[model samples]
Target: MEIILVVSFSYLSGSIPFGLILTKFFGGQDIRKIGSGNIGATNVLRTGNKFLAALTLVLDILKGYIPVIISLQYFPELIQLSCLLAFLGHVFPVW
Candidate 1:
């Protein structure tokens, strides 16, 4: 039950598409159709905002890292699964 909740939350959080939204909001560009066609930070960089790109990268990584870390703190055995779930969220995001 807890594992399901944790993975679901991680997926939802990671699928935020921050890089794409921020780039469009600030630079008025669709980051997804540019560069690697990815909604990640590197694609955000193509939008011409170095600061925003860096921030997005850090935030994205944190999105994955934080969940694993939190899960580890509570249930050490779940650390690996948590990290994998986070990665999946970023790869196949809902948003």
Candidate 2:
């Protein structure tokens, strides 16, 4: 149960589309329609808002990093699963 909870948390955290949210909130444009049409920081940069892009990058990194750190501290045996789920969540987010 704890493993499931941790993995779910990790995936959900990674699935947050920070670039899309930040760009839309700050730039008033859908990031998906921007340059590369990607939801990552690289595409956020295309919006010409360096601060938003950097912030998105940091948030994205933190989403992944925080989960791994939690797994390391609370469930070291789940580190690999946590990392994989986080990546998958980012690549295939529910949102």
Candidate 3:
């Protein structure tokens, strides 16, 4: 289904652990073991790169918002239902 594909793509995008990668590739620390130990925005700040963490937060919000906007533009009302599920998928990835 087109809707399924759209949500799947959005979740995939959101689930990308940018903070984790930044820590590993650049700082050689697994961010998950640091301060708050979350892969999300707040924990990233503990890495001492406030700018990068802020950027990641903005980008993460956009990662959810953009796909929802696109789905709305094309499919309208259905995006409301789908976007939340997609966002949840990102927050708690099973894949």
Question: Could you tell me which 10 consecutive residues in candidate 1 have the lowest summed lDDT?
Answer: 9-18
| Tens digits of per-residue lDDT for model 2, 1-95 | 98898889999998999999998888789999989899999998877889998999999999999999999999999899999999999999999
Highest TM-score, which number?
2
User: What ranges in model 2 sit over 4 Å off?
Assistant: none
The sequence of per-residue lDDT tens digits that candidate 1 reaches over residues 1-95 is 87887788777776778887778888788887788988778777776779999989888888887788788888777777788778888888876
Write the number of the candidate with greater lDDT, choosing between 1 and 2. 2
**Per-prediction TM-score, please?**
0.85, 0.95, 0.82
Residues 14-70 of candidate 3: C-alpha lDDT, one tens digit per residue:
677767776677778888898978887788888788886887788778777877888
Clashes of each: 0, 0, 0
Better-scoring candidate (TM-score), 2 or 3: 2
TM-score of 1: 0.85
Clashing pairs in 3: none
Against the reference, the lDDT scores of all candidates come to 0.81, 0.92, 0.76
State in Å the error of residue 91, model 1. Answer: 0.7
What is the lDDT, from 0 to 100, of the residue 76 in candidate 1? 79
When 2 and 3 are scored with lDDT, the better candidate is 2
**lDDT value for candidate 3?**
0.76
* Alpha-carbon deviation at 46 in model 1, angstroms: 1.7
